[model samples]
Target: MIRIRKAETADAESLALIGEQTFRETFGAFNTKKDMDEYCTKNFGTRIQQNEIADKNKCTLFCESDNRIAGYVQINLNAAFGAVADTSQAEIQRFYIVKNLHGKGAAQALMNAALDTVRRLNIKHVWLGVWEKNLRAIAFYKKFGFEQIGEHVFLLGSDPQRDIILHKTF
Candidate 1:
């Protein structure tokens, strides 16, 4: 069974590990080792996670299986990054599940938690960016009722890549 819960500051280290592990597992083969190493080191550091946990505008949730973190999702409550029409918008910053748990309903549980959090916050809209080349991830978002709205450039280390922006209105 997957248990979804709000992440506390104590989870920073675990988040860092899972964040890097999942990220590398997903994108490592597509990119160079230098790029992956740089991105992971800069973004998944424990200190950064600690600061993120302290941010009031961000909500991070973890999905646990057998008492270990199986996945996680992070949302930016003050999202205005892309073509948002109003203040009733939030961004699904990062939604990642371990490779081993990809098809085991962990993602669904984590997504449900994110949507519940958004609805409880009275945010009527949600959006996220997915790499254009990542068809699996795009399909997953589409299955969750998100639609393509726009495109933007995302920097993965030294690489400038295009990310298709998807939006959903609750």
Candidate 2:
């Protein structure tokens, strides 16, 4: 069974580990080790995770299966994106699940939780960035009615990759 719950500050390290692992599992092959390491160093760290957990505008949720964390989602209430106006919107800054749990309930649970969170907070729109090459993720978001509104460059090490900015308006 997959259980979803708000992440606690104590889960910083575990969250960081999962972030790094899932990111590597999903995109490691296409990326150079140096690039991956640089990206991970800047984005997936215990201190950074902890700060996010403590941020008032951020909501972090964990998906647990068999007493172990299977995935997580981080929602930003104060979403800042050039594609959309900064009003009445939230952003799914990060959403990741272990490769083994892809077809399982982890991703669904986490995505549902994220949407529910924003809805509860009275947000009218939600957005997220997905790599252009991540076809699976793009399709998944499309299933949730997210439409591509813009694009941005995401720096992965020295490579500047394009990310599609998808949005869903309630």
Looking at model 2, report the run of 10 residues with the lowest lDDT sum.
Answer: 78-87
Q: For each candidate, give its TM-score against the true structure.
A: 0.98, 0.96
C-alpha displacement of 125 in model 1, angstroms? Answer: 0.8
Best candidate (score: TM-score): 1
The digit string of per-residue lDDT tens for model 1 on 1-170 reads 89999989999999999999899999999999999999999999999999998899999999999999988999999887558777799999999999999888999889999999999999999999999999999999999999999999989989999999999998
Give me the runs in candidate 1 sitting further than 4 Å from their true place.
Answer: none
The lDDT values for all models are 0.93, 0.92
lDDT of each residue in 50-153, candidate 2, tens digit only: 99999999999999999999989999998866667758988899999999999776787788888989998889899999999999999989988999999999
Superposition TM-score, candidate 2 onto the true structure: 0.96
The weakest ten consecutive residues by lDDT in model 1 span 78-87
